[model samples]
Target: MNLHSTPPRSGAVLAALAGAQFTVMLATSIVNVALPQIRVGVGLSDGGTTWVVNAYGLAFGALLLAGGRAADLLGRRRVLMAGLGLFAVASLTAGLAGSSDVLIAARAAQGVGAAAIAPAALALAMGLFPSGAGRGRALGVWGAVSGAGGAGGVLLGGVLTQAWGWPWIFHSVAFGTVLVLAAVAALIPRASSAEGGKFDLLGTVTITVSLTCLVWGLTTARGSGWTDPGVLGALLGSTVLLGAFVVIERRRSDALVPPRLFRTGRVAAGNLLMALLGSVWIALFFFLPLYQQQVLGMGPLATGAGQLPLAAANMLGASLAPRVSRRIGDSATVIAALLTTAAGMLWLARISADGSYVGHVLGPSILIGLGLSTAFVQLTALAVGGVPPQDAGLAGGLVNTTRQVGGAIGLAALATLAGTVTTHAAVTRTPQLEAVTAGYRAAFTVSAAVLTAAALLALLLTRRSGWQRTVATAPARRSAEPRASAVS
Candidate 1:
């Protein structure tokens, strides 16, 4: 699973990896549509219902770096298998849970498994294909499936909740996990450990706790204000822990994340772009649904059905991204994609209370879906472009971590912004629907501006060669992968 080798079984390998990722993304979104049924089924309080989602996200985001590092150190195949087993067990437990506590705990366990699975899957995919066009095409397929997974979850959740029950959603994921686990075992070749020695312990613990505090603080800030004592305490605690992590990394030869990785301009710039794009991308999903349901009065099924066009366009754009990247280079293609996404956001900002779905939502959704997927694909590829074999897992984990963190920050801030706008509009004697629509529009406008800033920054970095212009192909660069180790 390295350069100059394409096994005949590559398709099966890709499917296994992609399916695992699909499950991870699907698990994140599906619960939203079924939340009501889930609440009644488990007798959850409002806070408990919210924690059902937050539990998964907090664990997923917090442990991702450690998961990726584990993949490298423990061996990708072993880690993926173990993760799938844990995911399957958790999914079943969640499906069978009769109490709120059990369900939330199981969801957190699922996230723990997902943190391991996501990085391991991506790292293995990278290993299957060589650098340049081969890897780009594989990544395109990865992007396509990932986008479809998220959209599909919304649709599937509604259907599952209506026809079967909320538990079926979790059950479905369990079934899929079992299928992919079998495929992975049969198809993927076993990988060797990155090195004989163990990974850094203190650094891992510090960073994991730091990230947990950061995500928890952000999650809490959505409901509680930023100035709330708990939120402030958690944020301050995270900052302190992060500082300790940096000091430990700098001093340790076997750092949890090698200090030199950040010095690579490609990794640095690419992840920065990822954070920016992910913020806007996540907010789009959140606000769009609220606009559809609350403003336009669409039911859950209709809302999910309406997103079919968006999902199709996303897959189409992802499929086309690799070819576009090859022709224009990664930086140029990413810049163009970002601009396209910004334009879509601006178009969506024109949403109105009285507007029809076909008239208002459809066109902007197609544009956003196409441009967002393309941008995500190219930027994701760019993030891992110059990394050596040993760093692949870390790179995979880093990109996913940034996306999750960005998504959390974006959703919380945008929700707060929307609420503030709605409150102001209501105070001014605007009608309820109109005021809410105004808030949605404001969110979209700000999202467009953020995307524009991302595009501008990418353009500036490309011109300055802060992003390695030839990193996409990587033929000229030496494979400077340092030896890494397994944690005991």
Candidate 2:
């Protein structure tokens, strides 16, 4: 399977790496679509249910940087294989779990596995492709995997949950992981480890603890209120731990994440866009199914079907990114994407209990999907675009960190909003269903507002005279070489 020097083999490598992304994304999406069923089956309370998704996100976000550094130190191939092994086993555990605790624990483990694999996979893709146009195309395909994952997960989750059971969704991940593991063994060439560094245990601990506490507080704050002692304690604890992490990194010879990486406009902008996108991204994932099942009275299958437009549009957008970027440049493309997404979110805010899916949901789905697809492709390109080849793993890891942290924060924020709205509406209820729908609408409005801000942020960062100008002025600008040169 060693295709180290052969250019054609790069395609095989991308396939293996992309397949890894596809499998992990599928596991989450399918789970998301089946949330209503899972709630009933696992006896998850409204507030507690968020953990079904958050557990994975929190672990993945917290551990991703460490995972990336580990890949650089241990060898990408070995780390990737180990991650696959852990993911497969965790999937099995999640599928077979008889209780909520077990399932959540398993999902968290799966997230850790995903965190490990993501950096290695991206770094390997970079190794196979190099920086330039070819790398951009490869990154285009890479971006597609992410969009496709979001869309496809709903469909897959729908079909599996409806036909089989929620457990089957987890089982399917296990099966897919096994296949991907085998495929990697058969397809991708072995890569030598890049230069290594000492393990940053203190930096790793500080980040993990800091992020966990922060996300926990945020997630819990909706029900507990910001002033709750528990919430305040977690937030304060997070700040102290994170502050220590920054200091620790400054003291370390080989820090987990170099402060210099933040100096690049693309890197910083990409991270911001990712966090904003993540917040909006996970909000939809968290809310849409609830809306469909609760407000629209859609069955699992029907709810899953409802998401078809979003998924299809996302894939379409991803496929079209290369052409769009070619015409408008990445900055313009990203700005357009973010604006479209914001507009869609605003439109979606108008959805009433009586609203039709095609009339209300379809257009927003298409716009949001397109926006995310475009933004994701360019953000990824920009994030990794400037890194030295040796720091490819770090670049990949850091970008992912932005995305996952955003996701965690978004879920917490939305869940809290939803809870507050529902509780308020409950007191004013004439009919229970109407009250619930009102709450959902309220949550959607807040989500739309959040996404609108995200759009502004994306616009500001990607503006020609703002961040893009910085990218243009950088000492070592990314060469706009064609994909063939970058990949070969």
Candidate 3:
């Protein structure tokens, strides 16, 4: 069942893997448009509602490294199938949940499944296509699928929520997961077992506990003050656990994540950039629906229609990213895309209580979508670039873990800032709409600043020399590679 010995049905393999990734991302974004309905239906308070999102992000981020290591040690295909089965069951549970608590728990279960599926799928794809032109093309397609899924979710969620109900969003993902499972079973070959090594149990437990505590602390801080005893305790606990994880990893031969992975500038910069991008990207989806539906008095359907341009633009950018990278180089392309996205955020920061979607939302959505999609393609390539094949799942997991963790933490911080701003405005007797708009604007402005900083960091940290080394070594490795002959 070693995929290395199987026939190379690269097209079919890529399609199956990308489809699985699409399902996971689509589930994440699909909830955004349905949040208002879910809140109302489940009788959730504002503080309780954020948990619906945070719970998933927390579980996904915290366990991703362990999930990746599991994929490596247990065999990627076996882990992937099990993950998909779990994801399907979780989605069904979510769809049937009648209370906020039940839904949140179900979502967290889904995250556990996603943590396994994401890294294993990426590792499988990487195994299918060796580094060189083939890897570049496969990554491009992968990026496009991710962008399309994320952007398309808003529209799809709106349509389903308006026509059927919010639960259909979960139902739809469940159905898609079933389809992906079938395709994956048919197309992807079984992976060989990794070389014998003990699982890093201490490292896994500490990292997972640390991230969960950290995200919980941040999310709780929005409702309870930062100085609240619970908040302080959780944050302190997270810090201690994280320190322990680092120490355990340094001492362990079979580390959950090899410390040496971060020594490469490409890996470090790529993950950092993705973390920053995820912070803003997730926040945008969370807030925009609220702005459109609550502030502008649009329906779910209208909001979905309004976001169609973003979906289209994201696909366009993803499609163009490989060519753009070829012309400008990966680092420059990423820098340019970040700057473009920052400008879009700045424009969005101008939103007002009386603003129209056409004037205030459309243009910026397109711009931001394009920038994010372009960056996604190159970032995906950069993340797995120059990594040995055996560690592919670990690398993928690390990149994705940063993104989800960054989203969880950043959203909490921005949500708190927005709430504080709105509360102060309310105390001063500002109009409710105006106060809310002010809060949203504040978040957008801060998001812009974050993206700008990411661009600067990418510029300083991503070295051309590292890319040259990858390119030079890639062909030599490919020359010694055996060709697989699977039927597509």
Candidate 4:
């Protein structure tokens, strides 16, 4: 289909695309609250349980570029449907898993599916809305959907795990996948495949291997010391592999990630900011539930309930972000969001064994949620800001890949740091509760610092001159065309 020439069915297309995006993102964090139950049910060790999360993230992060390029070469609708089917099947397999190995494998399979779905869905959404206010609004809704999915995953996982079993989380995802599949079939227009590009097999393989090795090394650092030969070897191998992949991409005629994309300052800055933001956000989800359950003696249901405010605030912030950006500009919005998030993380660093949920958790959650939601919308726009239409899927994949890879690395590093702190404090005869709280606090402090650094980088690296030029020209560009139909 000629996306620009077609009569806009914006509502149906946006709904279908956003639904697919939500389904894929939901799986990203759906198991956070159920990690404890899954560990017991599958007889997993602490290290093995971590893989339950990392395996999916690693595969998803590694394969996203390949998937995005494939969608460009193949038809987006065709690739999207195939991905949804694969996701549903993988969800079923995960739900039925009786061993950690099986569950991890299934989760990795789900990641492969998610890698395809995310970029295609994002590209399709971009295609549905023309540039200017319409595109900005659509992206805001897209960001809101993504935030809701991430936050809701925790709530839903807790509810399902409490009422049924850990397996129910996967089952619920499977059901949602089926519904989204039907929506895609009905609402998404079929497009002719773009032909003539050679797949970058060498680049794909090397990059995938490099990321896999990096995640494996990070994950192993917790069990074996960071200085362990195996961990050091894997990390070194990953660095070499990544260097090789970059070389291959430079040489390839049809590179998976076109090197020119990195030349744009906004694209580069946005991606770096996303990487830092994702690291802290994922670490928060991983550690906060443990704090509530282990330190505050909260049940799964209560923990889930406590997260509702965060989810709601995230949605509200996302909806308002685009409007805010119109007045303040995207860079200013991003900087403001990062500073707000950093402040929230700093507040959370004060958590004590005796801290109350309302006093400590609720306030920080609101700040972090609002910050994440607002930043996510603007960052996504910034990442893809000036890219050609043909490269939308590639841009989407790059942003998503950075987020997943950052999450995987961050979770592993923070988890290891927390474990080390807790272990040392215990060895020194500190009370267990106090020791764990100290570890959480230390992690939160680091997270705050990371956000502060990201804010500074945004200030330094974001191309203000180029962005201002685009904003200055947007009104003239939009005025020449007829008004596009509103999605809602």
Q: Kindly give the stretch of ten consecutive residues in candidate 3 with the minimal lDDT sum.
A: 479-488
lDDT of each: 0.84, 0.76, 0.83, 0.83
TM-scores for every predicted model: 0.94, 0.91, 0.94, 0.94
Greater-lDDT candidate between 2 and 3 = 3
Q: Give the poorly placed runs of model 3, Cα more than 4 Å off.
A: 1-8, 464-488
Write the number of the candidate with greater TM-score, choosing between 3 and 4.
4
- Report the CA-based lDDT of candidate 4 relative to the real structure: 0.83
The number of the candidate with the highest lDDT is: 1
Model 1 ranges with Cα > 4 A deviation: 1-6, 192-194, 465-472, 476-488
CA deviation > 4 Å runs, candidate 4: 1-8, 463-465, 469-488
Which residue window of length 10 is worst by lDDT in model 4? 479-488
